[model samples]
Target: MAVAYVYGAESRDISAPYSIWKVVGSLLFIIAFIPLTLWLVKKFQLAQMKLSQSEIKVVSVQSLGTKEKLMLVEVEGERMLLGVTSQSINHLKSFSSNARTFATMMDEASSPETPSSTEEKKL
Candidate 1:
């Protein structure tokens, strides 16, 4: 809008035509927005994932990079990968266009934790 306004003012034309470069620029802008929007969307999804669940049974915890940890959990027969850190948790998973159930059995197997008892331990 700002750029369009500037062009309109310079040309003294209320209907400043949209050129190919302008279209290309718009296309490039939209293309650039793809990754950024995806990042934001992922951030929101992770936030919602973290907040929606009552609890996440730590399926498997492993080192991500150095200080980060990865977690897996099961719910309604679906698997989710969670990124744990000192500050917050981030959910990382393959992008799905529509609603789908991801079969992540291997991930579950590789990341299983030793099941412990809920009852008091007889230590």
Candidate 2:
């Protein structure tokens, strides 16, 4: 009688329903989750990139040592030469954006002086 009872219990457990829908749903959820996570990561990365965009532009850089550098940057129509290191950034010089170029100065120097201007200078 005890053997029959044990056999009956085992048969009841084996006869339990196996739902195919549950297995299919879990697989679909797993498949959909990967792309969703990747999309969210990409969206946040784009937002961070947009936030970092600014008017300040780096025109040039020269490495001085292992950790020291010289950087030329332009911001708000002013150009700045800076010394940069791990500890601090120092301003070396600044240039006005509206300043004339060397080429223009050379052209002015090479041009012939008008007679009226020369006469005015003598007077």
Candidate 3:
């Protein structure tokens, strides 16, 4: 029916109704276009963000309230405690990489239960 309609339209037959192929083609274009456009947008966004230059990495974030939170951020080799609110973000304190805070984090990452450790605990 759609092929017949298209053939009639191409032949300038005014009596023929609209083609189903036109509607299907439009739907297919929209489906393909949306995902392709979205992927391009995401690729563009990732390209714009320089991960290497972003030295301040968020180690952890804790919510205190609906609009207030605490964040532990590592800037260069130093770690800092941050107070975050809806209006602003403030640095509460800064500590060196050798600080107890960082040592504790390292200890947690390489705990006894981790598979890589060959040493067994003596009872």
Candidate 4:
């Protein structure tokens, strides 16, 4: 009976430290897992963005009113101007292949035009 009681006490003492270690290891694993999972998700999202980079691009956007906007989008090398409202999106214009880019148009608008050589000769 005494040997049996000693065996039980020894087993309990051995298991107590191991059980505490197990709980601590589990808690540490959980703490590490959350950030690791978040990091992996962010990496995958970045990879997807890189893969779809050139498919469709938004060149510019303008807000007309509270719920209305104008969006210039480029898709497959074609540029389109779209008017967006709370209710619907309407296609305002489709640029031709030879049409100038938005930056060129802005520059031309901002710069003062000078008379040509022919105009000067005529004058």
Candidate 5:
């Protein structure tokens, strides 16, 4: 709008002609936004799909390199370690139901000790 105003002032034309380039650029952005928005929405949907009740979930991920990773995934209460690379994904190991997860260990470590429990143990 500023650029158009300056052009109009310089030309001394009351009805300043709109720049074709600006109109074309604006139209291009409008057209491009739809696909860009759709792509972003699709990517977000795929990311959110990783977790759901009664479905497979990625518990944790360890990146080895740009395209290599070790992922711990849970499916139907069974946890499995998978080695992922650019070529393919390989199953490393399977964990049983009684296995202690990293989350459980972290929770135990971070939890505060009760004063009553400590006094009882001392007694």
Candidate 6:
């Protein structure tokens, strides 16, 4: 009979201390994870920003892809680009020309040399 009970014992009480500990542990895990989850969400939402500094100044914003959540922002004179991965921001060729037409810019205000051919005296 003892051997039979050992093999086919009634289910243990789920309301026991071990069960209570499991519930508490699960709750603690959820609570602890909340802030980290929120932080990652916030990080996901931060837009990549770039500024151009020229007569045709521009600013642009782009969303990082799920696989490309890490962005590289580059500013060269009045040109800026955002890339999944690149040697320079120059890779960012998509600019809101509507915005660029109005906000001549860059982060460091570097003025690239104007094309010498375009400097002819006005008639």
Backbone clash numbers for all candidates listed: 0, 0, 0, 0, 0, 7
lDDT of 2 at 84: 100
TM per candidate = 0.33, 0.39, 0.46, 0.48, 0.51, 0.30
lDDT (Cα) of model 4? 0.91
Tens-digit lDDT track of model 5 for 1-123? 999989878885533445666678899999999999999999998877755444777889999999999999988888999999999999999997579877896899879679888899999
lDDT of 4 by residue, 2-119 (tens): 9999999999999999999999999999999999999999999989888885768887999999999999998887889999999999999999656998789899887855678558
Top candidate on lDDT is: 4
Candidate 1 structure lDDT? 0.69
RMSD of 5: 9.4
**Candidate order by TM-score, highest to lowest?**
5, 4, 3, 2, 1, 6
* Reference-based lDDT, each prediction: 0.69, 0.86, 0.82, 0.91, 0.86, 0.53
Error of 4 at 51 (Å): 0.6
Determine the backbone clash count of candidate 4. 0
TM-score of candidate 3 to 2 decimals: 0.46
Using TM-score as the measure, name the better of candidate 2 and candidate 3: 3
Sort the candidates on lDDT, descending order: 4, 2, 5, 3, 1, 6
| Candidate 5 clash pair list | none
Candidate 4 stretches with Cα past 4 Å from truth are 53-55, 58-123
lDDT of 6 by residue, 77-121 (tens): 434454653333435454443334323566334466446635653
Model 2, residue 53: what's the lDDT? 65
How far is 109's C-alpha from truth in model 1 (Å)? 19
Query: Which of the predicted structures, 4 or 6, would earn the higher TM-score when compared with the native?
Result: 4
Off by over 4 Å in 3: 1-18, 50-52, 61-69, 100-123
Query: How accurate locally is residue 122 in candidate 2, as Cα lDDT from 0 to 100?
Result: 100
